[model samples]
Target: MLRLIMLATAGLLLGGCLQEEPAFPNVDLHGRLVVDQEVTGARQAQGIQGEYYKRVLSVNGQDMAFNDFVRHYCPDSNTRNETCIKAFRIKKIDDVSGATRFLPNGL
Candidate 1:
């Protein structure tokens, strides 16, 4: 009887675990953005016209606009510096509008 009770308890626990929702439901939106340092005056004098940086939003390797990424992920833009490395995990993407809904994970 004790063995049967233990088995039932274990089964109940496992069932609960199985039914629980994932931390990021439906889609696992995880990616990194690597922003490079600003070009110095000397570099610009040598004909560097614009900022040199790499922006990547790897939503299953799908490409996203830099502006959209910044708007959604980088809320506190004032604190941003030349060099930045940020990791982001969004909650879900709108199926129809393609809008990104992010989790409360801070920058």
Candidate 2:
């Protein structure tokens, strides 16, 4: 019985680790979409090399990471599609620095 309990506990812990992160709600988010370039030396050393582009949502000056946006608005789909774009109510696109910024409607 003790062995079974230990096995069950371990299984639960592993299951939790394998689960996907919680997604944000699909509410109207007012923000600017910006591209954040992420480079990891560790990943490159492991033979995975490339510039990873993360879509950051800057709302009221606060930045939300790509995972949250993709999980909420475009799960299992590309983040640059019309659905994701329309959700933010894009106003203007500007090339600032190395990031592509999309201004939200209104401001």
Clashing residue pairs in all predictions, respectively, total 0, 0
lDDT of each: 0.43, 0.49
Which pairs clash (backbone N, Cα, C closer than 3 Å) in model 1?
none
1-107, model 2: which lDDT tens digit per residue? 99999999999999888845345444444443442434445446679755334346653355676446545555544345564555433322321222234444543
List model 1 lDDT by residue over 34-87, tens digit each: 433543344567986654434445433567644455455444544332212232
Assess every candidate by TM-score.
Answer: 0.23, 0.30
In candidate 2, what residue range of length 10 has the lowest lDDT sum? 90-99
- Candidate whose TM-score is highest: 2
Q: On a 0 to 100 scale, what is the lDDT of residue 63 in model 2?
A: 69
True lDDT of residue 24, candidate 1:
24
TM-score of 1: 0.23
